[model samples]
Target: MKFLADNKRTLDALNNWVPNPIILSSFFWGAGNVDQRSIDGLLCSLLHQLLKAEPGLGPQLLTRYPEWTDRATYHDWSNKELETALFLAWDLPTRTASLSSLLPAAEAGIQGSMQTMHF
Candidate 1:
């Protein structure tokens, strides 16, 4: 049980780093008609490239929107929901500023870490 719990926690943490389901779904929708295997391969390739180029962006997005745990689940989301999630994921500065304002604890934690890292 503990192992399962720990694994779930780790997977959840990792999901935070990956792209949201809606983004993935949008990409797939744009991929045009293709065999399932090829589509999967394309998506994997695109996701790999995205992660390589933007290291923490994936996790940051996942952290910002916990609803995007499973990519498949996003297929059912309304267009408005998808748009909102995409906006949040793509606009980090705005998200960060909003978060900093809404969550004083996050701001304090960041400040504390910055203070300790001073050379």
Candidate 2:
């Protein structure tokens, strides 16, 4: 929930409880559109949010995938590429990025992604 992410008191408590203090969340609303509910879309949204929060990860990502260094073609992300990018973000040495996604229970595709992540 947004409250969990915005509440500073709770976040402070969580910071003491977890090694990696930063908490990020993404909410998925289908709005009756198939593309909006796909895993690729979720990855893109999550990656963008992650990059904004931790700009350091951007160079690491570029290091691994040199082709993406060019901003002109950065938007052309495939599903597999997005998944790989997320993995690379997670693999960063000092940064431990955590993401929570709110998915529609009825949307099987997104639900599958949650299951894959062991959520």
The most accurate candidate by lDDT is: 2
TM-scores, all candidates, are 0.31, 0.73
How do the residues 9-117 of candidate 2 rate in per-residue lDDT, one tens digit apiece? 7577776776556666666665745545667666776777778778999988998799876546435776678878876786675334355656652346566555655
Where in model 2 is the C-alpha error above 4 Å?
18-20, 32-36, 70-75, 94-99, 105-107
Cα lDDT tens digits for candidate 1, 23-95: 2211222233442223233333334444445567678867877776666743455434544444444454321
Residue 53 lDDT, candidate 1, scale 0-100:
51
Error of 2 at 70 (Å): 4.5
